[model samples]
Target: MRIFLGWTLFPVWSGWAVTGPKEVTAKQGSPLAVSCSYKPGYELYPKYWCRPGFLRFCFTYIAQTNGSEVTVTQGRVSIRDNHTSRSFMVTFSGVTTEDADWYSCGVKRRLWFNPQHSMEVMVSPGKAGARRWWRQWQRQHSRVCLCLCRLPGRGERSHHRAGIPGGVSLGELHVPARR
Candidate 1:
């Protein structure tokens, strides 16, 4: 005898989803990109934004179907459509670490299955030391010693006597107490 599964017995459809941004970076202010993808034919109809298992923020209109843009939070949050590839480009400028969370992109189609995509947006504050060192390093190799100090802060003063890479010399750290 053959047994059948409930879901398999009925018509089933397949939808596509994305999890991460194609490219991401953490700047002085936190910014995030919510990614989404589809399998075509499932036109990004009536696309809706949500907080995942929570509430729906906005829904796209037919006029905005092919392309649309929405601004939120005093223009801090915005969504741009990439009709060429059927992807939504959502951006959050001046974002903070607390902005990290799961966002949902819901799509409606003829199929009752109703497609949905989600991505976690993580915004991290720029690494202070790393950024400072990187900026100094870009100026000139002679400033590398200063870059090192930025990384280790006051502790690096002692290591300054250890010499820097590229055979560059650094001044010694002299403490009157040690003398």
Candidate 2:
């Protein structure tokens, strides 16, 4: 579930200063929040959030950061802030293997600079049944489109980065069959 909470910064790229949940856990289809606060000097750019995995170059711009607030318009992605905390909430209706990835939230104000306030979202199946269901569904359904299996195997998957980190790369080895 990719949601746009508006623009926190823009074109300006820096690094993450502080972030939240440290380590968050949730069951399939549950709500998730990946939040962070940039250095006082900079803010997050309200860019449209994108899907977890894809085969080609893709990106969506949502809005702009007015001052400290961002407005995002994507599925279930939302931004909430208080004096002490700011974060992005990612909600999924039916969690699948496709929903797993290490999400990064940051801002890029310009091309010359790097993004700031980067955070990682580690999404995993809450239970073995959830994972098994996802695999069964995929094995019986996938038609060879774009895959996000950075470490492809009989069942394991990976995320495809859009035009970043050279897109996506898979490992040489695969995992043993899960029984």
**Clash counts for the predictions, in order:** 0, 37
Residue 166 in candidate 2, Cα distance off native in Å: 47
Q: In terms of lDDT, which candidate is strongest?
A: 1
Summarize candidate 1's per-residue lDDT along 27-109 as a digit string, tens digits.
54756656565555444454544555533222432112333434233256665555468666566677765666666665655
Instruction: Flag regions of model 2 displaced more than 4 Å.
Output: 1-13, 16-24, 44-71, 81-94, 117-179
Strongest candidate by TM-score? 1
Tell me model 2's lDDT, rounded to 2 decimals: 0.43
Superposition error at 17 for model 2 (Å): 3.8
Q: Which stretches of candidate 1 lie over 4 Å from their true place?
A: 1-28, 54-75, 109-113, 127-179
TM-score of each: 0.46, 0.42
Worst 10 residues of 2 by lDDT: 162-171
Q: For candidate 1, what is the lDDT?
A: 0.49
